[model samples]
Target: MYYSRKRQPDDLPQEVTAIWSCTNEECNGWMRDNFAFSAQPRCVQCNSLMEKGERKLSILENTSPNHSKKK
Candidate 1:
């Protein structure tokens, strides 16, 4: 007999948007999504520290098999 393990899910993907903004309260500036995953992000308008915003799951598409038990 052989044994096997199931694979685990990976980290959730970051939010993808066409536009963004700086996180610095003092320097509220608008930014773009081109620099989302980069180590450093600066607000082009105010050159302030920027952080990715919370992800919003607007679209839902199930890729897993329907495993619901029949009644």
Candidate 2:
């Protein structure tokens, strides 16, 4: 008889925080979330392109390091 090991599911990456803002400067809307490694998110208020603002290195917290670096 041959024995085989079971395969386990891949672990999720560390929660990276980001702030998404609306492309329309007039709206100037924004939001924040613990973005997963495999998910695409958009602005909740204006439904505009969500740009990656900044990254948070702590748990249970949301920080925007590049709030002024919008593209």
Candidate 3:
């Protein structure tokens, strides 16, 4: 008997928005704007100031109770 499995892609909404990328060329790190704390967020990996840019990424869901809608 033989078995095989195929990798599946993530299920998320795609959109173009601001992003934070590490200034260090050696480190490859980034984050979405909506999830950032300030206008300019620093790279958590290398503690370097991140650069602002635009990119297409999956929509991150907001499941926090603090962000829940009123009834």
Q: Please say which candidate is ahead in lDDT: 1 or 3.
A: 3
TM-scores of the candidates are: 0.34, 0.38, 0.66
lDDT of 1 by residue, 1-71 (tens): 99767533343444454446687787767644443444466777677877665444333333436432223
Model 2 worst lDDT window (10 residues): 62-71
- Stretches of candidate 1 off by over 4 Å are 1-19, 35-39, 54-71
4-63: candidate 2 lDDT, tens digit per residue: 675433333444666565677767765554432224565666766666575543444425
- How large an RMSD does model 1 have? 14.6
RMSD to true structure for each model, in Å:
14.6, 11.5, 4.6
Q: Which candidate should be chosen as best, given lDDT against the real structure? A: 3
Could you tell me the lDDT of residue 49 within candidate 3?
Answer: 93
**Mind giving the per-residue lDDT tens digits that candidate 3 earns over 1-26?**
99767534465568887789999999
lDDT of 3: 0.78
Of candidates 3 and 1, the better by TM-score: 3
